[model samples]
Target: MSEENQNQKAMPASLASVAAKHAQKQPGTNPLGTGLEARGVHAWFGTKHVLSDVTLDFAAGTVTALIGPSGCGKSTFIRTLNRMHEFIPTAALAGEVRLDGKDIYAPGTDVTKIRLKIGMVFQKPNPFPSMTIGENVLSGLKLAELKRSNTDDLLESCLVRAGLWNEVKDRLKEQGGSLSGGQQQRLCIARSLAVEPQVLLMDEPCSALDPGSTFRIEETIAELSQTMTIIIVTHNMQQAARVSDYTAFFLSNDGPGLMVETGPTSQIFSAPRDKRTEDYVTGRFG
Candidate 1:
């Protein structure tokens, strides 16, 4: 395929009309400002037990960074919070993930609704390659079957929240893939925000970006944390220390991944109570 054709294939198509019919109805009210809690969470992929007895609380309006070595279940634990782990045929989780004291895993709970309340941004910028910039921002609302009276307003607000409004406002109809890598990632973030989620999960959202893009994403994260709970999985300890209010350290060696310690970001980096955490943060060991 030609480079232009490949680029076109990379950008998701417009979903404005679909979004208009079912855009996010509630845009003004902040649905998120509530804390999230995980209790005794354990996870398995097929027959391989990956995480064990993990528990943590992400306070409302705070950024919590999950840090550890590779293969330590940081991403697995993040997925479990929004129930994304269950997408795997053999994946299983045993624990309670609570949002504002309500158990998300309770019997009869709607998984779709749970996901809407908890939005996720993956490690790579996966904006719908066929969608326009504006359409990409409103795609989540369409998926959630929500309708808003003002889609234009919703698009602009979400893009602004993601720090992409000024840069892309003039090209709302442009393909999402037309933007730079940093812009595409921000567009993904804008798409997530359009759903009005209470908790946002980011699994290494900046891993694919250059340093400049990483800085912009970090800025966006800082801004978003003012109104929503954020849980991020990152291997960059410095990034964790720079952007997170609280940090949790995960480890795996002889057994399943486990939480070694969690505390304020400053405390965890400056004076970790656990030797494992100390070693990881100090670059002595991962």
Candidate 2:
């Protein structure tokens, strides 16, 4: 057998078209605003370049999945969108991440407001152990000093959107730490929803979860996408296919990670334009 034959693996059927047809039919425009846009984005830590020239359009009310191998800079790219990357002492970045047609990195922009419009849910569940489940959901409001009437309604709405309301509604006074890991993650998501962000960034939200938990998270993601833009970094191709409207593939070749290809989820899974993407989706290489 030759090397070419050895490299060929069975291609996955078009899971996106079959599993995420509803996502594809979602309205591309959110009544809130145009989607977030990234152009010529790059990132570095001290002298080591991590990401290079990533440009993507995340339409409002849609889910875009960043699919790539570990260390391809998927998480770093999303961090830059909301200025979280600046928190790193040695982190450096270039290019523009625009929201509502304005550059987020513009001088004197309110960092807090940017974050309010673009929220993040991390890989690990980090609900505040000291706070009760209900308090944890509404913590953002107090921390941001934004006042609202009827706290109970907001708590229930956020929890409902996060798909954890039924299970935790009776347990609202209980500490967030008391919940299982899956419930804790959903609680963290509910916490993010309290402020009502227009865009949400999820960095491998389901990576640490079991199958049942992962399915619940995916369901939450689908519901969330109907109102706001969502960008998720996922290594699970099936999840990406099942949840995202669009998919971006990233890779690194002895240098900075680059966006290899991006397209509608169905097309990316069925007929990727780049060989590298096909190779990765076919399990020939990362």
Alpha carbon lDDT of each predicted model: 0.84, 0.89
Q: What's the residue-level lDDT of 182 in candidate 2?
A: 92
Q: Distance from true position, residue 188, model 1, in Å?
A: 0.3
Pairs clashing in candidate 1? Answer: 11-129, 11-130, 12-128, 12-129, 12-130, 12-131, 13-130, 13-131, 22-146, 23-147
* Candidate number achieving the greatest lDDT relative to the actual structure: 2
What digit string (tens of lDDT, one per residue) describes model 1 on residues 1-286? 3854443333222211221222121222444544899999999988899999999988777788899999999999999998999998999999999988999999999999999989999998998988888889999888888989998988899999999999998999999999999999999999999989988999999999999999999889988877888899998776786778788999999689999999877656655678677667767877
Question: How many residue pairs clash in all the candidates, one count each?
Answer: 10, 0
Give per-model TM-scores: 0.88, 0.94
How far does residue 111 in candidate 1 sit from its true spot (Å)? 0.7
The segments of candidate 2 whose C-alpha lies over 4 angstroms from its true place after superposition are 1-10, 14-23, 26-29
lDDT of 1: 0.84
Q: Assess the local accuracy of residue 2 in candidate 1 as a C-alpha lDDT between 0 and 100.
A: 81
Which RMSD values do the candidates have, in order? 13.8, 3.7
lDDT of 2 by residue, 1-286 (tens): 3543333323554553453464474445568688899999999999999999999988888899999888899889989989999899999999999998999999999999999999999999999999999999999999888999999999999999999999988989999999998999999999999999999999999989999999999999989987889999999988888988889999988899999999888777766778899888877876
